[model samples]
Target: MLDDFDRVLAQARRGSPEAFQSLHGDLVRPVAAYLRNKGVTEIEDVTSDVFLAVFTGLGGFTGGQAAFRSWVFTIAHHRIADHWRREARAPALVELTLDDDGGTTPAAEHHALDALGTARVHELLDTLTPDQREVLLLRIVADLTLEQTAEVLGKPAGAVKSLQHRGLAALRKIVEPEGVSP
Candidate 1:
């Protein structure tokens, strides 16, 4: 994908429908998942909105794939913040997942939680501050590099690093208390 990214991006910039489709196809899932992890309620709608912004702004966007990814997430981050601001409330802590029926099911949700330990994961994540949580999400769930996470957060890389470190330490303490290790 990276090998053809430049060509595709250039074509997309020049108004190529195929190129735009390719870019959207490549990015949509991860972007959606990232937004979901960030607790965006309107995942599909917000994901579309993010890509719309990306495509509209692609003409002036100048960078390789890494930068492009960071740029996309930067937009997503802003959108999530905007959503929360408009609602004027904290995001819901629940991580909603759909079953094969295209709706949430108790059995399927239980299986999923057991398989991924998602309930425990969410509980642990809830212990961190919002900034620490966002840093971890961008770095781990979004599979972004330190620099990319920093770019998304508009912070110095060192600040991101510190957040990640502290966040991990907090989790570690909770998971392995009193110097006891599993």
Candidate 2:
């Protein structure tokens, strides 16, 4: 898969369904994870939207794998900003339901555990400034290189580096207040 990425990309640009599938298989999980890390509540929908943009725009795109990754994430970053803007103007709705006998169901318990799994990480992430949080998410969750992260954020590489440094320092302070880790 790695050796012939250019071929795959070329095929995808020409609208080959198999090439598209390969691209989607490779990127979907990372893209979804990045959105989830950034606290985008509609992960699946936003991920699909990002890929839709990628697929439609592939004919005009020019780059290697790293550049393609950056481009895809650039679209994702825009979608996240759009999602937040829309959310700010409208309130989200939640539906409530009761299980039989008013007790929690096993399915509910499974979901609760899943939510709890990331709750601590999210709580810690919530402490950083927005720029710091974004840099860290792009770097860690998306596994993007420094330059790629800068491209995704539309910032200079040096600026991205500074944010990443500061963000990591802040997390260190929170996790290791005594300036030590084991």
Best by TM-score: 2
TM-score of each prediction:
0.80, 0.87
Tens digit of per-residue lDDT, candidate 1, span 1-182: 35799999989988999999999988788888888887777899899989999999998898899999999989988888787786676655776765565665468767886858766677878999999999999998888999999999989999999999999999888978646563
lDDT of 1: 0.87
Residue 102, candidate 1: Cα error in Å is 15
Residue 128 alpha-carbon offset, candidate 2, angstroms: 1.0
* Model 2: per-residue Cα lDDT over 132-161, one tens digit each: 999999898888999999988889999999
- Give the Cα RMSD of candidate 2: 2.8
On lDDT, the leading prediction is: 2
**Candidate 1 residue runs with Cα over 4 Å from true position:** 89-116, 177-182
Error of 2 at 105 (Å): 3.6
Clashing pairs in 2: none
